[model samples]
Target: MDCLISVDGSVTVSLLKSIFFIINVLFYLNYILKNNIKKMNTEPLNLVNGKIMTLNESFPIVESLTIKNGQYYSLNNPHPNFKTINLNGAFVIPGFIDAHFHIKNLGQRLDMVDLKGTKSAEEIENLIYNKSKTLKSGEWIEGFGWDQNLWNDKNFPSSELLNKTIQNNPVYLTRIDGHSAWINNVAAKVSNFDLSTNIEGGSIVNDCILIDNAMDPIRNSMPKPNKDSTKKWLLSGAQYAAERGITNVHDAWQSPEIIESIIELVQENNFPIKCYGMIGGSFKDFLVDFFAKGQYSGKQYKLRSVKAFIDGALGSRGAALHEPYHDDHCNCGLILISKEEFDELASLCYDNNFQLCTHAIGDRGNSFVLDTYQKYLKAQNDRRWRIEHAQMLTTNDIGRLKECSIIASMQPSHCTSDMKWMKSRIGEHRLHRISRWKTLLDNGIVIAGGSDCPIEEGNPLHEFYAAITRTDHDGFPKGGWQSQEKLSRIEALNLFTKGAAIAEFSENNRGMIEVGYEADLSILSNDIMTIESEKILKTDVIATIVNGNIVYGNKNF
Candidate 1:
């Protein structure tokens, strides 16, 4: 009886063990199969809101495009079971490229009192007076955006009158064009200048108003923005540009120190714009030292160009004209730097492989720069040097720009803005040949357009409108100023997009919408191609994307 019981218990335990093993294997296999199936059905995490993004070309039908790691690819037809957002058939184009901009300066001026719309000298004084009353006694009163052309007198305000408003503080005010400034006697003394300082290629009027290079001393003496303020300004400028659909900026002049600071901020994820900085003339030594330490590919913030000014602007009567100003006979404009200095700088740039962008506004200045560029190309056999703000050019000087392969970088709004007074300054015959984008294009010269912000606010729409219409914002003259010279919509687009990219020597990577290009694009709320030309300025930006990242957008949709 004992043997029988033992055998029966052992048999029961063995049966239970075999059944448990088989059940465990089945459960494991089922879990594995379910996990594999889930993995197989998973969709790649790539999606964007778009009914059908137009890349400056007509699309036959709606389609989804996938961007992975800054490269664009079309999705398979009748594609995946993944999530998607609808763009509602808005127009998408390459993000705008501002060839000339002052990012740091624009950023720093965000909090400064703006006097751009003040109609008269008295109005500006009154506004400054009220603002000064709040600041502590002795603190500097800094302001900007006063244009003498808008004032009743049409002349720069005297320092004596400016003193009445902010007499306790050392006040400094920049003109709207940034070519001139009004400084109190206190600032002049701090810079160790009275009425006798001989500022080369600049002037200090008897009333203590400084023009062109003369303002440099006082400006350099003023307090600079602290690191935090600098960062705030840069970020603000970037956000502002992005919101307006400007994805990239070619910063005209930046010091190496400022570049280093910006680079640090970018590494820490604080920067807001894709920037390419042209090191300032004053900081060539700093750039050289840094470049010697290491050569950069400009993957973050580019530092590959050197910016030098050959002359001042036309509004200040300092532009280097071939003939004396029609209004101011005593001046033929100012030759800011000597030819020897120019040749030395050119040679240095050629050796260093750094591109040069010289500011040449007056006819004489343009001639000299073009001559210098020709000489440099003959010596070095390279032709990427650009002339910034080719605002005015003599017929003789125009042909040389094409021969030397020098790019004529310009601002369209300047032509319209100066049209009112430019003739008065240069005479109708001399000024009639102004801007001449069509002339340059006809001669096979590449013209790149920009806003030169802080000089003129960096608005690409305003630039495009100016280019196509050649009229004031109000649609004046029933036709346009030099209407014959106006650019077609496509031509204007090329200047702002592809031409600008070519100026920076990055044409292959950006400036168009196509596969294998960086995913930098802008979406517009209105169809620019079909919108009325007069209403183009009213067009709004729906989104701005950079490197496949949605940096800015309206977000309402």
Candidate 2:
């Protein structure tokens, strides 16, 4: 009996020993799996055999680079354990960043009737008439990219033309600058637009046109895009940007719904490019909510700025100027926001630690914004308050930009586009102060370049060409309009890279191909740095890399 009891105790000990061994084996296997994943996640990606424009003062250029976990790891270093891509001697620069863009509008424009380059009012009317036929009766017919400046008549088209084309549908079309809209009587009646209504900062230019805040009633009456359409538009716009070698965009204005949609896309890993959003001032309630929520900085999105408009576009003569327009003796343009209101807005942004970007196109508009910004911002503080367009400025006010540490967020294309008739609008006397990129740069005031897409072509190449040449696509005016203001090739590149990055407070991690920076790059078919001015427009985007992954094109690997 004693021998049997001892045998049972031995078997019990053996069973316990077997269980412990199995547990140890399982734990070891789990440990191996986890570690393998960790290593894979941290593994480096090497790029070799390329002309890399680092834009780094220290390195400047490199033949190769290594990326680890989506950040630049090292220059001219290749890891044996990681994957390597040969760029085949392509010219690679920091990925282009559009400092100002309208993502939603760009996307929606893709589906709308494109009236760009329409030479006459008759052409636009025909385009709308054709578009109207596709939709059912009463469906809104929307179009964009129409500029009366491009027309031979060079006058605002009467709504009677649209009325003659399609009376059954409500037609709404926006001017290229987006500061004004031309609507038929049908749309005006639908929006309950009353000509007698007193709009403080807007004007109803006859029955056809509404300028600035005057168009709000019509816009509010329009149906808002639902979630699905919003998502589609955002994705489409982002893809369009990616294709253009743009990896980051500072969306100039965003609604709460659009911002939420962007967040959702980023969370789902559906968004391919990084977006820095500036909440629209129109959304007052959302601004209050966002201030309470503080700023959001994610892998692919950020929201920390608010965009306000002090005036309108110069093309539409809605930009508030100190003196009357040369073309219209009695008109000095409109001020969208009064100085008192602007001051209050500035206080809100300053107190909430949000960046303030104001649209100030004319001299008077710019002065008002500069004064308001000075009241809230201390000298040499890093507020980074920006004057969008900064189109027209007085000589005295130029120094104020430096005093306030303001960023001149100018669109190079605007200069070229407006050169055709800008002199007639403001006269030659004030021309020197318009889009003074070189002067602004010399004064130690940073100038961030952008296309202001949907208003312009939104192509980085176009922006670069326009900046350096100060000419249109055809290279007009021989020596370039405002030749002294033209930026050098490298300087032009910096406007879209370093300048843009600095504006968004991402210079340390982006804008340069330095070690430990984000692996964002734009590979071009030709060396834009050495290419001829006219050929710059012909240059093709070979590949656009964001976070060390190819998002658009795959020429080499």
Candidate 3:
């Protein structure tokens, strides 16, 4: 009886093992069958045009697709059956490319306080006063985004008034343009400079408004935030950028430390936004070291460019001009860097496979940059060097830009924002040529758009409105300022998308909704092309996709 029981137990264990094997086999077969059924149901679509245009009525409606190796590997193509995504019944466009962003500065500005909507000088003072009252006495109080134009009286506030209002705290408030700063006496003292100290490329106004180089002391005095804080700030900035449909940015000036931090974030799969960094001349070695490591080959983070300042901005009366400022005759404008210096740098960039992007606002500055590009570009043909800001250009300089093949990294919002005071600064004659997008486009110049964030909010729609309408925030001019210079909806979109992608040497990979391109796209809540120009500002981004993944979206479906 014991032997019989043992035999039965052995048979029971064998049967149980066989049953488990059969179940496993059946599960595997079921999975294969389910996948095959899915493949049969989903159809592959190949997109070629800017939009998902339907040309043939007989073509199968695409239910799913897989873009493999920059080509559509679909049911009809030579790829194995697999699942895919189909963006049906929706317009598709390339993701936005901000070609001239000061992303690092934007990151730093995130941690700083903002006072943009201050209505009057007293209101700005009160803002600092209230914030200072909460902090310990003598501690530095920093704020940004104060536009004098929004005030009851459109004029810069005196630092003396700030000092009187915030007696205990050392206050530093930056103008909306970021070209000027109002520093209290206590803040000046803490910066270790009084009325006597003057730094190069900057000025200290009589009432203690620091401009350009004059900001060095105050900037140096402020302690850099800790690593975690910096990371938090950068993350905040990135998330904000993504939500606005800005998938890629060409950061104008960056240090090695900042690049390291960005790389760390990318390694940890933390950073969602793609960045192309340009290391300034002051941080050239950082870029050199990075390139030496052969790490510049990545698609997300690159450091193969250098940004140099040829002159200051027009708002600050420091833009290098052929003639004196129309409003301030005494100041012909400042030349922060000479042509020879820029030429040498350009040559260095050419030899090292680095592209040079110089800030040239005024016609004089633009001419100088053009000459430098001409000198260096003869030796290296592939170097797509750029002239940052390329704001005001003489007709002669416009021709030179086309000859040199330089990219015009411009901000359309600058045109609308500066139009109010641009004529006053350069006279109507020069103002006519200022921000000449029409001539640039006609002459075949590559115009890449950006917001220069922190200085201007990184809103692509605002840029589009500014480019097409050529109107200020309030919708100035019944028709438009330089109505002839207005870009078509498609042209404006290209400036922020395809043109920007070309500036960063990423045109082949991004900038369109073609099948072979990177799956970087922005979906709008409304059709942009059909929308009224005035209503463009009201339209919002519904979703942003980067690298085949949804990074930002406001809707559920």
Candidate 4:
């Protein structure tokens, strides 16, 4: 009887093991079927007969590429079942990323009177006068992109002309750098701005011009754009960027409302380009709100950085320099934020793991930023804090950039735009310290290039040309201004690709054209790598693809 019972128990154990084995086999089959279904549902995109620049050292270039599931699937191997587009030997490279940009401002500028390319202040007045005829009485007549440096007189325009030109409308024209404003008597009266009022970190150049903090009162008096209008502006800016071959932009500054609008547009598929938003310090509560919410990392939009101003633009003599300006010997430029305030903000950002991007345009401003960064950040930490427009740096402070792991978020076009007056602003002695791209690179500091759009033309091709040549559109100064600082074609390309990616901590996924990276590409009319420098400006964007979908210039595809 005992022997019979033991044999029955062994048989029971064997039966249980057999059942478990069958369950395991079923689960494995189910997993395989699910993966196969997913693959079947995804429609891959393939590009053939193209000169694709991967920008990856491992696999530098390829002829054909495959995109599946919105990521690069293979290089030089077009999938047989995928939808294919014949490029006919088109030149393709990693999508351009504007490391520093102002999207909402760009949109607003589009609607305002375009003061760009106006030869003189009188021309600006004529344009404003024409725009005023269209608007109703007491309506604000806003204009931008006036550069006194470009004028023959090279002197700041007075409100005397605007006051006389337009009586019914209040005129407010912003300087090219957006740091100064030329307001008429009507605007001053409407905003109750007193000419004698002394403002900290700001200057009232005259009764008409207000620089840095001084422009705030007048700006606040103006009517704010409603939520709908803000959304419209954001869309307009994104569309404009797409047309210019920019797939990604590090939106330099944004209010909470603007950020919400961007997120809404992105979710609804209205935004065409990817944005890495920086919370603006101008909004008092942005940091608090941002900290509570933590960082946002959506597929098309990201928010993890804060933008604060250390000083103002060089054009207005508002950039804080170590010494008095060569032209204006009576004054050293203004400091918008104090060291105490900056350090406090830095601490908050450090604790919250938010990248701090400060607009430091002069040696003094850059020195303050670097010193503050050293206090909060460890040496060589991966925290890529940025100095937007590290336009000028003292010789001693150049090496401190690498030690603090700071990225120079420079706008290449700014160099060309400012080159005309750079010598006069800081004098010939400090000329080598301005826009030191090669010097910074040699010291192991990375540069993330951009357009600072609306201020400049905001064209990626223009930026590339400016970076390689260090010259304006007219190509003055013969062999390029500060020729030693000029970057190579590959270096300039990386500024908008790999270097830009590293600035935003997206280097692993977005910058390159390698397999497993996001399929963002810019197809150009000509190969910028091999073409003559001047011809680069003429090169048009054939196609701009984001997430494997053509967003701009799709007719070529």
Compared with the true structure, the alpha-carbon lDDT of candidate 1 equals: 0.75
Candidate 3, 1-557: lDDT as tens digits: 24333544554565465445444433433343344311111133333212331111242233333555433343223234443433444455568888878776677677667786778888777777778878998888888888776666666676668766777778877777767788888887777787676566666776678876677688779776765765666677778888888888888887555655665566556777788888777654444453444325354566678888877778877788999998788877667765666677777777777888998888888887887788766532557889988998899988878877888998999888878777778897776777788789999988999988878889988998898889976789767787888888878888988899888888777776555566666666556767777777777777776665567877632
lDDT of 2 by residue, 291-345 (tens): 8667766556777899999888888899999999999889989999777777877
Residues 297-330, model 4: lDDT tens digits: 7667777899999998889999999999999998
* lDDT preference between candidates 1 and 4, better one: 4
What would the TM-scores of all predictions be? 0.87, 0.91, 0.84, 0.91
Please give the range of 10 consecutive residues that has the lowest summed lDDT in model 3.
Answer: 36-45
Worst 10 residues of 4 by lDDT: 33-42
As a TM-score, model 2 comes out at 0.91
Q: Distance (Å) between predicted and true CA of 36, model 3?
A: 33
Q: Model 4 off-target regions past 4 Å?
A: 1-42
lDDT of 1 by residue, 192-308 (tens): 776577888788875567888888888888886676777777788888888888888888887644665666566666665578778787654455564444334444466678899
**lDDT against true structure, model 2:** 0.86
Which of the two, 2 or 3, has more lDDT? 2
lDDT of 1 at 184: 78
- Model 3, runs deviating above 4 Å: 1-88, 287-295, 338-340
RMSD versus native structure for model 1: 19.1
- In order, the Cα lDDT scores of the candidates are 0.75, 0.86, 0.72, 0.86
